[model samples]
Structure formats: structure tokens, C-alpha cells
Target chain A: MDLLPQLTQYAFSGLSTGAIYALIGLGFAIIYNSTGIINFAQGEFVMLGGVLTHFFLMVLKFPLVVSMAVAILVATAIGVAFERLTIRPLKRPTPLSMVIITIGGSIFIRGVAMLIWGKDTHSLPPFSGNEPLVIAGATVMPQHLWIFGLTLLVIAANKYFFYYTISGKAMRACSYNRTAASLVGIDVRRMVFLSFAISSAMGAMAGIIIAPLTMTAYDVGVMLGLKGFCAAIIGGMSSGFGTVLGGLLLGLLESLGAGLISSGYKDAIAFIILLLILFIRPQGLFSKAQTERV
Target chain B: MKRFVFSCSLFVLILTCSALCGASQPIKIGALFSVTGPPSFLGEPERNAAQMVADSINKSGGIKGRQVQLISYDTGGDATKAVQLANRLIKDDKVVAIIGPSTTGETMAVMPVVEKAGVPLISCAAGRKITEPVNRWVFKTAQNDNLAVAKIYEYLQKKKLNRVALLTVSDGFGSSGREQLKAQAATHGISVLYDETYGPKDTDMTAQLTKIRGTQAQALICWGTNPGPAVVARNAKQLGLKMPLFMSHGVSSKKFIELAGDAAEGVMLPSGKVIVADVLPDSDPQKKWLMAFVKEYQKLHKVEGDHFGGHAWDAMMLLKGALEKGDDLPATIAANLEKSRAFHGIGGSFTYTPVDHAGLAKDAFVLVEVKNRDWVLVK
Candidate 1:
């Protein structure tokens, strides 16, 4: 059989999944850009958002809208508190130490989540019905549309905040040069915390939207977080827009691989692509070429 | 000097009390299952059933006038964790016997530990390897894939479905079933038209199903756990491929219906007759036991118990029966289990011999079809 149609189907599936990866990648990008440290707990933020929403809406019988709002708010507060307590104290520590701290934070958060929610897979009702919409002999779930649309909206909002808003510009300045930003009267520490808060909120939003599609469990965050980190790295970890692009590409690759090849190797394809990209173009697909600094 | 004497006297008294308590203590059985991880669906149900059996047995004055205490640990579906838990249960908890570390991988990992400890282990999982290469202490209560596959072949032969396409998950359970089907297909004079494989977490199977649709197979044989069967049913409906679908007993759970929805209709699979029979003939010895278990389980859990729960109940009952007869808890339990003959269980009448640990016959399963979203006996 000709592989074209199969490849196309794979592409459609990949794009849907890639949209989710991009959202997660963008969250990583936002936090890394501001804090100069990878927030390993970013995926757990997504998991927390989804699981908390499930508890509030389904188990507690709260209205869906109210539960979602509360989930986001709680996730944002946690993001801020995490930065203020764990990350803020490690400001003067080595970058390696900060990275290790974030990893530790991720483990701690996952443990607490497991203890609180137990390890059952929890799912919420899809925002739309579960019917798959067919287009050109390919079917896509309605929830995939939500994931893609939300990714776009968040990206646009992030762009406007960073480029147009004064607070956003201050954060940007701090990312570029902390000493210069501080000299110019920007509160560098507060900006760092704000970046974490925003990034965490985005991560949580991604979790809430995708939870209905994939279901959520305590340990689900580890893989998602790793994949999102890979996406960010492949897209140039410093560039938020590039991270989104990288995530979409990774998602499409995975889906196509599952369709044409073995479904068992679907996850492996992403890491293979990641390794190849790093070997050939270490600067990433969209990042500016930079000389090594001594 | 007076204070020291008083403390010494208190210590001696505590030691004496503990020794007395230990001498007349209840029998402790270690139960391990995956309370966390992916297989929690199977493991959680097994755990609940095990606890229910233990509670019921104790309420009935336990085995031969001594209470039975169950100490359970979560294996998390990890082999390493299974070993650690088995060690803890044997060495630390000092349980006389152990029930499970459900799944083939975990069971195999903990087999050496249980064997070394000289404790009898009766597993609830269905991997035949647990009983083979034969450790004297290890016995499985659930029917292995060989029997399940043979039943499938029998059903297909009876229906005159000579041409079949197979789709299976590429996991240990799926691969084992596939091997059995392939081996038995020629014996039954059935033609294998097509074969496809998918992973456990796969959400879509349209591509595989589409390929299978082109084949002139009379029926589709799917081998996997929950979402796999559900996905197949949904995709088959979407492709408008109308043919009988046969599944292994692994998919025999209520969650299959919840996941598959309307697509679950007309799907036939093998299930233990004790669980599927709406009205058992009064002549059958297991009828009362099955009904009582069904009623109590439903009353307490507010949900119908499946073959998994029934299997757990049978395993516990076997242990109870053994404990009642055996003078030395471990050695006697093992001997009694081996000598078990015509024990009426919720699954079927079981008779364990030295060669076979799973005492029930392949005929114990009745072909069941989902009609109007409820299981109906087909044979």
C-alpha cells in the first residue's frame, strides 16, 4: 500500500498531540527565559490543575465553570509560592543546584499529589461531545480543537504581555540582563516570581484541557514534563514561540510514526528526532545562532 | 535500686504477655497487589475481593477456630517493588502464606523470595509461567491464556467461523494469547486471514481495523485489556464492519462497557459460568456459594463483581480450606491445595493435582455476548 494516505492520517493525529506538547513547551520556555533555570515541576503543575479540577467538578459536584476557575487560580498561587519559597532562596546558588532543586521540587509535588488523590486515573467530561469530526477521511476529536485553540490564545496573550505591557517588558529586561534591569529600577526578584506564576498558570491550563482527552494520574506528569522539556530544547529553550513550533513538530512525528510503523515505537520517535536535532542543529530550529562565550 | 527492680518486673511481664499472644495468634496471610500504577484496574478489584473474603472468613469464626488476618502491600506493578514487598511481608510481617503480586512479571520476581521463605503463594494472575518450572509453593487460581484461547477456538468452531483476523496488544499477555491462537488455529481448521498489533496506551485503531476490513475474515478476535477492546469495538462500528468479535477473559469487566458504550453490543467472550449464570440449576453445588457472594459483594460495593473478584474469592477459599486441614500452616496448606478435589467455587468445580495448579477445566467458561449492554449467556 502507498504510504501517503497513512502518513497524512499520522500527521493529523500528530498535530493534535503536538498542540498539547507545544502548550507544555511554551510553559517551559516562559519559566526558563525568566528564571534561567528549568522548572522540572512544570508538568506536575499541569497534572495538579487537571486533577484538582476533576476533584472539584466531578467528585465535589461543583459547576464546571467555577471548578475550572478555581483550579487555575490555585495552580497560579502554587506557582508563585513555589518560586517565592524554593526558587527564591536558591537565587545565589549555582545553576546546577537550582536545577537539582527544581527536580527535587517535582518529586515532592508528585509524592504529595499521589498521597492526596491516590493513583487512580481520573477523567473529566470533554468540553464538547466525544464525537470525532471527519475531514478528508481523517477523524479528529473535538477536544483536540480546544487544545489547539487554547494554545493559540495563550501564545497571543503571552506575546502581547511581553511586547506591549510595561511589566512584561520589565521581566524581559530582567531575563536579558539582571544587573541592567535592576539598575533601571526593575524588581528582578518579583519579575522572576511573576514569570513562574504565568508559566505555571499556562501549564495548568494545558493540563485541564488535555485531561478529558488522555485522563490524568499522579505519575503522568513525569513523561509529559520530559517531552515538553525536549520540545523546548529542540525549539530553542529561550524562545517561547520556538518552543511551540518544536512541540507541534514532535507531536506530528510521533503520531505519524505510530500510523506507519509500530505503535510501540511511537514514543521512541520523539526522542530519536530530539537526539538527531541536537546533533545537527544544537541551537534549535528557531533560535539565533550564537558563539560560545567564555 | 527500687525503681530499677520495678522497671525489670514490668519488662518481664510485657515479654510474657507477648509470648502468650504469639502462641495463640490468628493466622496471618500476606496479600500483595498493584494498588498504584497502570494495572490498578485489575489489582484494586483483586485487593477489595481479598479483603472481603478475609472479613467473611473471620466473621464465620475463621479457619478451624483461629482468626485469619490479611496484611496487604501495594506492589505498584513493578517487579523490584514486588520483590521488596514480598520480602517485607515474609521477613517483617511474618505472614504464614501470601496471596498475590498480581501479573506475571511481579509474580516471577517474588517467586524466589516466597520459595526461599518456604511459604505457599497462591496468585490471582493468569500467567502460566508462575506455575510452570514448578515451584512447589506457587499456585495460580486464575485460568491461564492457554485455556482461554482453547475456549475461543471451541466457540469459533461451533459457530463455523473458519476465517478470523486477530488484533492484539504487543504486551506479554497479548503475545502469549496470540501464540496460543496461532498454535490452535490449524488444529481447529480455521484460517488466519490477518494479524495486527498495537500498544497498550493507543487511543485509535482505525488504521489497523481498516486493514482488517479488507480481509474476508468471518470474525475479529481481539486480545487485550480494557481500552484495547473498547477501541476495537468503536473502530469496528466506525468502519461499519459487521462481524462477530471475540475477546479474551481479560476484557471481562464492567469498565469495558463504560469505555466502549453502544459499541460493546454483540461482543462475545468467555467468562466463568458461576459469574455469568443468571439462574444456576439447584443441582449445581456452587449455586448457593456464588449467589451468596454476588449478593453480599453487590450489597457492600454497590457494583457487580466480575471474574477477577470471583477468582480472588476462590483463591482465598482454597487457602481457608487448606488452613483448616493442614497441621503445619505452610506445608499443610500446600499439600491440601494439591490434594483439592471437587471443590465447588464461584468459578467452577476445581480439582488441583500435582500437574495442574489451576484446577478448573477449559469448559468452565460459557460463551457470553453483550446484548443491550448487559452480558447474556450464549451457550
Candidate 2:
């Protein structure tokens, strides 16, 4: 059999899933860069967005757009609140403690979600049409286009915010030197909280956008979180653009692996790439090599 | 000291009052289902079906004036959690009998607890080992993987598909199916052309399918839940392999259709009778009740009922019928179930004996094909 068409199909599938991973990974990058603490509950924020939206739209019979807006706003508020309560308390504490705290926070959120939502998988209406668009012998869902376009828009907006906005520069200064930024009268704490809000919103937005394709459930957050974390690490954890690239690469690799090789080992391909990257570069694709100052 | 004594007395009084109120209450049955994990697709439906059955029986004045109360716990598809849930249900909830810890892994995990507590436990999913070495307290409403294998073998023999390739998940369900298929294929003189296995959440099977393609196997038999069968369907189509594809009943879901798209069409599987409720003859013994159940379930849930839901309905109804027949709770229910014969159920006519806990025969399943992304009778 010809491999070109197969390869193309794999690429299309990869790109579709990659778009979602990039959005989630970008959320991870934002939190990591700002606070230097990985927000493990990022995926739960996404789940909360999709689930709340589903509840409002499907159960409460609210208008779809209204529900979507409410879900994003609510999820973002939750993110900010979580940081204020959990992460803020551990600001002066050890990094390991903060990491463990975030993990615990993730589990707590997931547990609460289970109790509230009753552990049912739910999906929202696709933002675009449901028809598959066949391009050059490869067929992809129209929703895939929506996800990819949304990912690009989010990335552009994020770039603009970080490079142009005053708060963004303050946030970047805090990331560079928290003590110095605090000395300069930059509200480092507020920046940290803002980072969480932005990251959580990104995650929630990813969930809302991709829920139509992958569906959403309480437990789905774990897998999404893990994949997004992998994407962040692979792309150079501090770089937003690198995170997106890494996510797309990882998604493409997994899909192509499934298409060309054994589908069963599709997930395995991600780790394998991870291992190879760590062995070869250690500093990640876009991360600068650090030298210890004497 | 007088105040402390008065507080203690009040606490005791409240406890006694609550205990007395609970003692005069309905017969409670605890159900542990994997309602929040990978298996939620199956467990959630089973829970709903169990609740539906309980509601129906209660609406009819329940079993001989005692209401059947179902207490459910989410196992999260973890074996350890299944045991924990089972203990909590038995101890805290004080349920007479437990209806499920759905999958075989979870059932086996909690089997010891049920056996030790001497409580009757009926599982909804199949793993033959659960009942085989004989745990008197442990029974199942669903047929074993071996029976499904036997049914598939019977069809393969009829279709003259002598050469077969196996693609299964490397888990309890897949391993059980693989072993059964291997032994049965040998007995039926069917050649084992190729065999491949994959992890549970795998989304591709091209490599295995390619190996099977080389073998020229007349049929490809896939065993796993959800995406396993979907991956097989998609990969098989991509490779242009025209062999007849057969799957284990685990993949009998709308999720498979949604995942596999048009590639799922023409895939054959040995499905439980409940899947084709409309195709059953009007004169069939359980037709009216089954149809009513389907209508009610669809009306309430807004989704088509699956074999999992049907099995739960049958199990709960059987238990209800047994409870209604006798005064004693556990003993009478067990005896009534043992003596039951040709009881018309959504899964077809069931006959339970002390030895056979499943209460259904191989004939309860009919071979079905995916036609236009929906299950259709093979005939």
C-alpha cells in the first residue's frame, strides 16, 4: 500500500489533536513561567469549563453563547481563587511543598467535581459545523479547523499581551526575579494571581473548544493534564511558542505513530520521544542552556 | 458532671431514635459501579438501569410491602477502590446483598469481602474466573467471555471462516477472550493465522493488522472495549483489508461508531439479544415487557439502551421477583433465583440454578453486524 496517503491522514489527525494539546500546553507554560510552580489542576479547569457549560446549556437550557461565557468566567475565577488559597499560602515555602500542594489541589478539585457532576461524560455542541472537510484525500472534521484557528488566535493574543501590556511586562519581571520585582513596587503577588487566571482561562477555553470532539468528564482531566505537561516539558517549559510547537509535535508524532506503526503503542511514542529529547538536549527544544555562575 | 451526663444521654437518645427509624425502613441493596473512570461508559448505564428497576418495583408497592432501596458507590474502575466501596457498603450502608462491582477485575477484587461477609453479590460484567472455582456468594448477571467466544466460534464455523486473526487488549478481558478463542479455534479446526495484542487505551492497530493481512486470515477477531475495536476498524479500512471483522461485545457502543465512522460498517459481533429489541418476534415471551422497558429507558435517559443496561434491568427485576415471592430476604431471594426457570427477561429467557449463576444460555446472543453505524441482525 502507498504510504503517502496514510502519512497525510496521520498528519491531519495529529494536527487536529495537536491544536488542543497546544492550547493546554500554553496554559501550563503561562503558570510555570510566572510562578515557577506547575499547576497540576490546569486540566481540571478545562473540565470545569466544559462541564459547567454543558450543565448551563443542556440542563439549565441557557443560551449556548451565554453558557460559554459564563463557563470561561467562572473557571477563570476558580483558578484565581485556587492560587490565592493554595499557592499563595506556600509562596514562602519549599518548591516541593508547593508541587505537592498543587497535586493535592488537583485531586481535591477532581473529587469535588465528581461529587457535583456525578461522573458522567458530557459533550457540548461543536462551535462550527459537524461536517468533515476532505482535502487532498484526507478527511477532517470541521471542528478541527475551529480548534486550530482558536489555538492560533489564543497564541497571538498571548504574544500580544506578554510583549505589549504593562501588566504582562510586570508579570515577566516577576518571573525573572520575584524579589527584585517586589522591590521595584511591581505587585508580584497580583502578577502570580493573574498568571493563574490567564492559565486557567486558557485551559478552560481548550476544554470548551475540544469538548465537542473528545467529550469531557471528571477523570478526563488526568490524561489531558499529563499530555499537556508532557507538551510543556518537550517544548522548553518557559517558552510559550515552544510549548505550542512541542504540543503540535507530540500530537503529530502520536497520530502518525498510530497511522504508520501500531495504534496500540501510539501513547508510547510520546514517552519515547521524551526520552530521546532528554538524552540529546536535556535543556529541551527551545530552552537556553544554563551555566552555573562561579 | 451533670451537664456531661445529660449530653451523653441526649446523644444516646438521638442514636436510638435514628436506629429505630432506620430499622423500620426498606430493604437496602448496595451497588458499587465504576461510575467515574474508564469503564464509566458501562458502569453509568448499569447504575441508571439498576435505579430504574428499583424505581419500577417501588412504584408497584415494592417487594411484598418492603421497598427496595439501592445505595450506590462510585468505584472509579479501581480494584482496590472496589474492595473499599464493598466494605463501606456492607458495613456502613448495611445492605443485604450487593448488585455489582461491574468488571471482572473489580468483581474478583471484592469477591473475598462478599464471600467473607456471606452476602450475595451479582456482577454485571463477565470474567469467567469470577464464578468458576465457585464462590457460592458471588454470581453474575452477564454471560462470561468464554460463552461469547463460543458463540463467535459457532458463527465462524457456520461462515466457514477457518483462518482467523486475533487482535486483543493486553488486559483481563482481552486475555480471557484470547485464551477462549485459542482453545475454541483449535477444537473447531480453525487455523490461528496471527495474534496481536495492545494496551487498553491504544488508538491504532495498523502494525498488528498488517501482520494479520499477511496471514490472509478470513476474519479478524478483536477483543477489547471502546477504542480498541474502533482502531481496528479504521486501520483495517486504511490498509484496504477486506477480511470480515468480528469484535467482542465490549465494543458494542455508540462510541465505537463515533470513533470509527464509516469504517465500522460490516463489522460483525456476537451481541446480546437486548441490542436488537425491535427485531424480536412479537409473539416472543418477553417482547411486551422488553419493548416497554426500552421505551421507558429511552424516554427517561434520552439514549438507546445497551446490553449492559438490559443485564442490570434483568438482574434487578429477577431479584425483585424473588423478593416478592418469599418473606426471608437473602435466603428466599437466593432460593427463588435458584428455582427460577424460563423467566422472560430483556436478555431473553433465563433459568438460574444453584450451579449456574448467569441464568442465561448462549442462545441469548445473536450475531449482529454494523449497518450504517447501527447494530443490525445478521439474518
lDDT of 2 by residue, A113-221 (tens): 8888865556567676655577775657677788888888987888788879998888878777788999999998899899999988888888888776666767678
Docking class of 2: incorrect
lDDT of each: 0.80, 0.79
The sequence of per-residue lDDT tens digits that candidate 1 reaches over residues B1-379 is 9999999999999999887876568889999898777677668778888999999888988777778889999998998999998999988998888998778889888888988888999988888888876678988888778777888888889889899999988888899888888988999989899876777655557667655665689989999986667877876765566788898887876667656767788998887765565555687677788888787788878877767777778889888888777764687788888988888887777888888787878766767888877888776
lDDT of 1 by residue, A209-263 (tens): 9887666767768878878888887887754568888898888777666555656
**Per-prediction DockQ scores?**
0.25, 0.15
Q: Over the stretch B230-277, how does candidate 2's per-residue lDDT look in tens digits?
A: 767866775567889999988776767766667788998987777777
Separate clash counts for every candidate: 0, 1
Instruction: Flag regions of model 1 displaced more than 4 Å.
Output: A1-5, A238-241, A291-294, B1-15, B21-25, B34-44, B71-96, B113-118, B156-167, B189-222, B226-248, B260-287, B298-309, B364-374
Q: What is the TM-score of chain A alone in each candidate?
A: 0.94, 0.95
Per-candidate chain B TM: 0.92, 0.91
